[model samples]
Target: MLLVPATAATIDRRLTGRSPVDGRPALVLLDLDQVQQPADEVADALARFGAGRFADVRQLAPERPEAPDMDGLSLLSDLMPQVQKALDSGDASQRQALKAEVDAVLASMPEAPAGRDQPRLDGVLKAMSEALAAEDEDAKPS
Candidate 1:
């Protein structure tokens, strides 16, 4: 796998939309070389950017040998549409209901067989997608 240097050009477009990054988001500069990198490295190079700051590798795994970040490609593809529907429906009740469904999926992981934690992550991804779809209840109503 190649090392896709986390440069200013690598800022995730999703983050930039939430808060316009002046240029070259912070995460772009985080150094992933400090870690005991895997043979296949699979560097993520997360840096301070968008709504947050501080840089770190998001994850390092051997199974995925992609040098370029694949964070945008979520495993919960099936659940994303449900999340999008809830968000666009303008139905708070529907969104909350979806969140509960997502939580239940996550909490079920403890009973899952060991070494199968990927399913747990799948649940987390689904839950987060649902939550992200929500209008921040604390935010003044848009």
Candidate 2:
């Protein structure tokens, strides 16, 4: 008769390979303040990092929707579609008018600490504004 004491490392290795598990959740630290890219891109990159190296990776912190900056960003998101629709179908004159409204909304946006969606929203709005302005210029009579 042969006998071997059953242990976690043996069981874990048999089940999943790479045993001697630490039993502590591993963490991946990222310093985003230095990333200088839109938040969505950063988030996408993090999400696409398929789990093999580590046990898990997930959103550790959620954006505070109650934050004032979040509220402004939400408002900008709501307003963006209108701007897009106007650009798509409305005449150049209408686009110019909407552009002023966009500028005002942009100017009124309060300065708040960076959040997940804030940079993304800012980038989209700036790009949209620039596109509308360019279109307006092209529409101008020479």
Best by lDDT: 2
lDDT of model 1, residue 51: 22
lDDT of 2 at 47: 50
lDDT of 2 at 5: 23
> Which structure among the candidates has the greatest TM-score?
2
Full-model lDDT for every candidate: 0.50, 0.59
Writing each residue's lDDT as its tens digit, candidate 2 over 21-138 gives 4333222244556678976776666557733433222343343466446675777778778778877874887777877877876677666576434655566677777877988888
TM-score against truth, every candidate: 0.35, 0.44
Expressed as tens digits, the lDDT of each residue in 1-142 for candidate 1 is: 1123354455343332211223332322333365576623333332223223432223422355336324424535656788788777778777778777767656664554665444445655665745654464733465
Candidate 2 — which pairs collide?
A: none
